[model samples]
Target: MNESIKKVAVIGTGVIGNGWIARFLSQGYEVTAFDPAAGAEERTRLAVNHAWPSLEERGLAANASKDRLFFKDDLAEAVSGADYIQENVPEREELKKSVLHTIDQHARMDALIGSSTSGIKPSILQSDMIHPERFFVAHPFNPVYLLPLVEVVGGEQTNKKALEQAGRFFSSIDMKPLTIHKEIDGHVADRLMEALWREALHLVNDGIATTEEVDKAIIYGAGLRWAQMGPFLTFHLAGGEQGMRHMLEQFGPALKLPWTKLKAPELTEELKERVISGCEEYAGDQSVSDLEAKRNEFLVKLLALVEEYWPEESQAKANI
Candidate 1:
């Protein structure tokens, strides 16, 4: 694929949309953004500016041209002649359906349309679209320019060509694109993350650990391994010379132990209060921006390390 990715359109200039803009702009794509909310353009510009320095620090934005970003009040104007269209609207089903419908009506037939939806499946969201085949999920984690994992999920009506095109497009921008085999609620990463979040909430509710301690348990333990490799790969390493088979044989019995609760905990008020309080206490001095900057910094370094360790294979897959 060519390194050039000119004329990308971003809908909904919120946090995720802003990140998408940054990623595209850093990759030398001329970004045209549309957002109905007032002051959305200013917010997007601020996000792009803030992200620029971080991208520069990581050497990803070197030799990349700037001033290719454009903002528009009209969605159709943004989508016209766009090479790729990324929709990052609110998570409401009706809102997404409406925006996609409009995009389907206005966007060029060949332009790829992707959603940053976290939980909503593309089938339901793109049900009202005239060209659902051109639509698919390109879900990215928060602060999209830094993180490299973009879950690419296709709906029932989503075409194979579109998925392939999207996969290629993300790769051009140095993103890791994981094509989900089937549509599942919350997709892959979010489903696994939600499970962990539920358990964390349960532990807090049970007074087992504070939010900070729980966070430390992850950052100090498996999270370090996960930064370089996933759970299965880590287990494969844990197996020593024998591999996963040996590891499983040795620890399979632990699965029977009461180690984790797979069931989700009910969001009762008392439990919610405990979780909220714990988080607030943990987040005391740092503002959201401060924490996000720290996270972006860490993610940039971590992904760069992964790229260095397993350059060929990992670089071909990971996208944010």
Candidate 2:
């Protein structure tokens, strides 16, 4: 990892773009953002300010001597000397291709570019880039400053060095980088999450439970276990001394039972209303900002617990 990679450019100023800026700036990177949209500079500044306290609370902003940040109106100026570039524009293929094409013509050749794409494959995202090897997907969850996971995916044309450099860069910022071996739709975490989401929707549609109850099923039960250990590891523990293989052998037959419908339910108007109403009811007296703050607090504490207990295979990189 290069300690000298102090400059980064963030392209786009939407919600995700603000998140990328927060994560980068909190890690002491001098972030320069480019977003031609009206009020983008103000929005980015507000997001960064809001994130600063959280970063300080986590001991991530120990080095405050560095310049706070910079916002650029010129795209060329933003990418001119950046060590890395993070693209968080809308998920329009043509728009992405156009932006990357322009960036390819302007950015430093050796600078790494990452896309905050949730579902798009890197191959498709970088098809038109002049230097595709320097570009790849570095998808991070919402509120990137809180969630540490960054899924790094390389396309067929992606440079190995770029991927390795991305891993190092994300680690330097205290992020858990998971490199996908192949280009797959939705990558890893989202795919697993979508599967469960489909079932959750199905249950709601079938009137098996209200949305709040379904949320309870997660927050009050298996979700707690999942936060500490993955499903396989949790099941291994469930099997006691027998471990996963033994548990699988014993439970394999029951797996065929019609427990869950993998099919997703249609987002009908009534279902949508039900979900909205359920959330509104759950919210009670809390405003959206208050609820969000509470949620973020829980996530930070939960993740800290995970790090303390079930450390990842790449735990050594956390100290970088």
Candidate 3:
């Protein structure tokens, strides 16, 4: 834990917000959270309970406890004394700005504010704030408690020291903070994901593959390699002795082929129902909670395996 950031506040209780709360509690941070929705506190507690087993498997800080979470009805009161605040409101531009303005007004001036937005740029999100310099995008993956990657991006007005502190704080909590020097829509991971998603939708819409088939393609093949070395190094290995240089020389022309439709297909009613029914059929008897539990267990084991093979030096080189 960053000693300068003892108290933390989470300013929403949606899926992402609850995930953040679970992670903070597991890391032994006292978290005060606010959300206006009725029964928000109950749902958050339930989410924490659901995620606890995974956190325990990952390992817990000495002081970690679910009881450290406090629910406050008033947003101002929730943020007033916090040294770090995370905003995870729904992805409406106007609403996020309004809520951020309120947090900026109430939080301590030195408090570092991070938004868990999936796509919005940090500069636009921090534009209306008085202390915009302290604000940045801290976009995290779903299942935030178990997933270690957090994309840390500073806004145009954001201070270098603020980004540095946020990186250090996230690192202390057992997270891999990837600081993005340039901001773009969907940051880094999500953009790559969105491209693949668009292509997957196109395949489904064109009747080329079923949802289950698409999933199987990734699950049995690229997903396994991606889990460790990611796309570049995986492709590099394809070059045999020559590595990436020879691989690119042989396959680079394939990039110009019409192998992908970058634009996403429209979500017509037929497509929507096909997708919903396909997923439901695939899910069969298992509830979402059941699947989540299984996924968490798998990830805990996979993460352990990943750390063994994907050492820090290799990861740094891959990033470069």
Q: By lDDT, is 1 or 2 better?
A: 1
Please, what are the lDDT tens digits per residue for candidate 1 over residues 202-313? 7887789888899999999999888877889889999999989999999999999988876778889988888788777788998878888787787777777887786346
lDDT of 2 at 100: 78
Give the runs in model 3 whose Cα sits over 4 Å from its true position.
Answer: 1-3, 313-320
Error of 1 at 207 (Å): 0.7
Model 2 quality (TM-score): 0.92
Report every candidate's CA lDDT. Answer: 0.85, 0.84, 0.93
- Give me the candidate number with maximum TM-score: 3
Q: Which stretches in model 2 have alpha-carbon errors above 4 Å?
A: 1-4, 65-67, 311-320
Clashes of 3: 0
Lowest lDDT sum, 10 consecutive residues, model 2, at 59-68
Model 2, residue 297: distance off in Å is 2.9
TM-score for each of the candidates: 0.91, 0.92, 0.97
**Candidate 3 residue lDDT tens string, 1-320:** 13398889999999999999999999999999999999999999999999999999999999999999999989999999899999999999999999999999999888999999989999999999998999999999999998999999999999999999998899998899999999999999999999999999999999999999999999999998999988998899999999999999999999999999968999999999999999999999999999999999999999999988885656556441
Worst 10 residues of 1 by lDDT: 311-320
